[model samples]
Target: MNWIAALPMYNVTPELAAHWRALLAHVGARLEPWLAARGDSLALIEPDEQLERFWLRDDLLLSQTCGYPLVHALSERVRVIATPAFDIDGCAHGNYRSVLVTGAHVDATTLAQCQGLRAAFNDDDSNSGMNLFRAAVAPLALGKPFFSAVLRTGGHLQSLRALAIDRSADVAAIDCVTLAFVRDRLPELADGIREIGVTQSAPGLPFIASKAVPAEVPALLADALDDAVRADPALARRLKLTGFVRRPASDYASILDIERGAIEQGYPVLA
Candidate 1:
């Protein structure tokens, strides 16, 4: 059978996208012979469909998904492979936090001061963008609307633009890795944004494979990731990747706890 793979979560710019493709190709090369021995093959094509649909495919051999969906929508259908540990300020022990950013022009220095202002988030399913932000603001909401309006920007890049360039929104919650990439590769977007606060840390995105794959596949992929980093030190540094660390699904249950905490506080949505 032919399987597929993707590393779509952090491809914030064209340069970053090319790097991720190269990394994926390298891992695929390492896995090819092993998979071929078992009469299986892996494809390095980028998924052309929506991520949720791509994740659900039976032929998905490798992919990266947010912790929010891993706990809420994908726990049973996909098997946890490993979490990539990044060498960045907001990351530690394979866990990462979201940085709350506001435009340079905005005078709100803290989250509390920004109450009732416009807000932007990448997607509701995004742990960094929505869940963490919801958890952070839930206590302040007190069962009432906090932001005057909430915009769904579809991606961190767009959310950043909504906060800095267009000024359509006053603040956004962005993944720390994405912020680092923008600072390195897309500096113009990073220029006028200010990190006002950070959300509680949780396990970063986890690599996942379809449950139908062989039991050995997860460890194989983890080894491939380590090999990929060693083989290309320059690329790994540019990607801010240190190595892959195996983490159980239970480590991600805290993400649900964050959501439940918000809902219990009557702040289910990011409003």
Candidate 2:
């Protein structure tokens, strides 16, 4: 239990959280049979723990983080283990996109129609929530901002709720994987979640280990990820996990380009 592990981003509902626990347990079990050979061990960080606090912990053996944060803030502090390949509707292999969704009552069906409407986003640093959506909106903004205002919901699920349930915002760009999970697991939150537009796909959230770990850890992790998916078909189904990829760090540079592309278009922020 000296090392930490978590898959916090997509656990937007209780069912998904339980699935994540199961996924972790399966991965941990795979490790237990071999980790001792390297004098290493891992354990799930309590699901209820404040996950953001573990981003830089030395004991953080495994975790998933948004691509934006991985490029913008965490590149130096962590090494990517692998990118999970989800079998969700809006994702392909290890890449995912964001959907611009509006209330079913809203007539808008395209990004242009949603112009000047209030936008809800999970966070400024979120890749699928804000950065890619910002990029999608940048070209549409010839010289004026698209959304009249922007709401900063704390996370992807919260952003989905802000538009789908609370009605606090007219629209929001939700992570496709998160949306898929909500649509399937949390029917209440998906009631009016209609997708109007989808952003360009990019590398999905990646599993990252602190750089303090051994140089060989990334390959070890990649192997374990593939093994876990192959060894436990039921667990893979629970999480909609199809497989994983050994994506190079350079593959994530596109996220920075999207952020920079938006800034260059005179619409740096979502608003």
Candidate 3:
């Protein structure tokens, strides 16, 4: 039988790698007991593979994915399992927001002042990294794009580096919950970044399963996630997770709406 597993959206820095492993391990361990009870075992795939490539594959029993790709990219390829509730700034229940961040020394506070500056995004398919930030800048785009150029940093951590270390970008949008973790784990790195604005809250990343997975798996996974948060003190403390909530697909429609609204407004892409 094929194995099933879980993965985060992207890799983390070396310093925080162990913490991520522990969190995923905790979730995987919590899930397996229940999965085994049903004659299904949840395996933890710890490859360095890009998550976006395998998220829709047949063996993708469970994985966390951003809302942007969930709507614009994956669509019906995966079924929603449950949304993780995180205790982070700009997050309530399972809805979370993105932060427009810049180098701590940049004196400009308003988005308009930073016009024509370089902007970096994690990926074109990211909600917090791209779409919402695009919408955030759409009003300022007018007839011209906001940044003189755009850089595809491939990951939020890369975008953070572009702003704080490389100095290649004047601004970037980061997931608030991810920021919370980085700040908690890597305070010195976090100190180099500062938020100027925040995107509207959308549903946080949802755990998804490939259509091939058992239909009853979602309910069991949800129960396991809640149990982990309530019972796994280490994981709960590290992730600041409250619980899991089942948010309808409609909860993510607003993200697509934002994308459409931006496109129709003559700002097809982030300015």
Candidate 4:
């Protein structure tokens, strides 16, 4: 059977997808002889059904900003190959921390002054939306309640849009990477939104494969990815990828640890 790779749709567009396909094709072609030597062929699938196949076929998956839930869901079946936690940089907190805005036309000072405001969460299972967000606000809510209301918006882009369009939420926490993606792909929406503050940095997503696959698969994939990074400047620039760095399971354990700490501390921000 041909082994497949799945790409997430969150930060990807059709044009960008085409670019990725071409780049992957180059990498795949270079790796084909080796794969064929092992009686396997490589294929890249579309974001929709292909994603399902990845989950089912025990192939590899690549995603950004999809750590928490994906890991939770697939932990028993897969192992993380590599991640970019060390290289991925977030926006400076001095300028772009998450804010609590109001439809009543509240300024930063006024919003900050408000004792209790509504908050919107993209998903309870997101690292950026939950883990980093909790770490950012936990200090401030040391002895007081932070939000009067909290609503789940399903995804980051939807949460951002909900904060602007619904008039129900006073604030929403967004990831810097997602913010940049929106700025590049959906400029109009990005123009209206403002970042109030930034959260602490956490690791980004990992390229994961089924635990059943031979260990050599991950080693080979990692090598091909490193070569792709070294040879293709356009690919590196487009993905903001510095390079693939090997990560052990312990690196991701901190994410689960943060979530557990927040829950134990009775912080509703992550719940």
Query: Whole-model Cα lDDT per candidate?
Result: 0.91, 0.82, 0.78, 0.60
lDDT by residue (133-165, candidate 3, tens digit) is 888888888847778889999888888888888
Using TM-score as the yardstick, the better of models 3 and 4 is 3
Q: Write the per-residue lDDT of candidate 4 for residues 1-271, one digit (tens) a residue.
A: 4676655534435766676676566668767878778888777876465343455455543332255655576555676666642223453221122332333333444434434766677776677766667765565676456778777887777776666666666666676656666667876556655666556555566666666677676776677777877898777777666676776655666667766766666674532
Give the poorly placed runs of model 2, Cα more than 4 Å off.
37-40, 47-53
> Which 10 residues in a row give candidate 4 its minimum summed lDDT?
91-100
Candidate 4: C-alpha lDDT: 0.60
Tens digits of lDDT, candidate 2, 1-271: 3677888888777777888878777777767756787676787866465455577778887889889888877877788889988888667769999988987767888988988888888887889888988889899987577888889988877877777788888888888888888888788789967888789989999998888876776776788788888988988987888999888888999998888888888988777
**Candidate 1 at 104: error in angstroms?**
1.5
Model 1: lDDT to the true structure: 0.91
lDDT of 1 at 211: 90
User: Could you tell me the lDDT of residue 230 within candidate 2?
Assistant: 92
Which RMSD does model 1 reach against the true structure? Answer: 1.0
Give the Å error, residue 208, model 2: 0.8
The candidate that achieves the highest lDDT relative to the unseen native structure: 1
How do the predictions measure up, each by TM-score? 0.97, 0.93, 0.91, 0.80
Which 10-residue window of candidate 2 scores lowest in summed lDDT?
Answer: 45-54
Candidate ordering by TM-score (highest first):
1, 2, 3, 4
* RMSD to true structure for each model, in Å: 1.0, 1.8, 2.1, 4.2
Q: Judge candidate 1 at residue 232 and give its lDDT.
A: 98
Highest TM-score: give the candidate number: 1
Residue-level error in angstroms, candidate 2, position 166: 1.9
Model 4 clash number: 5
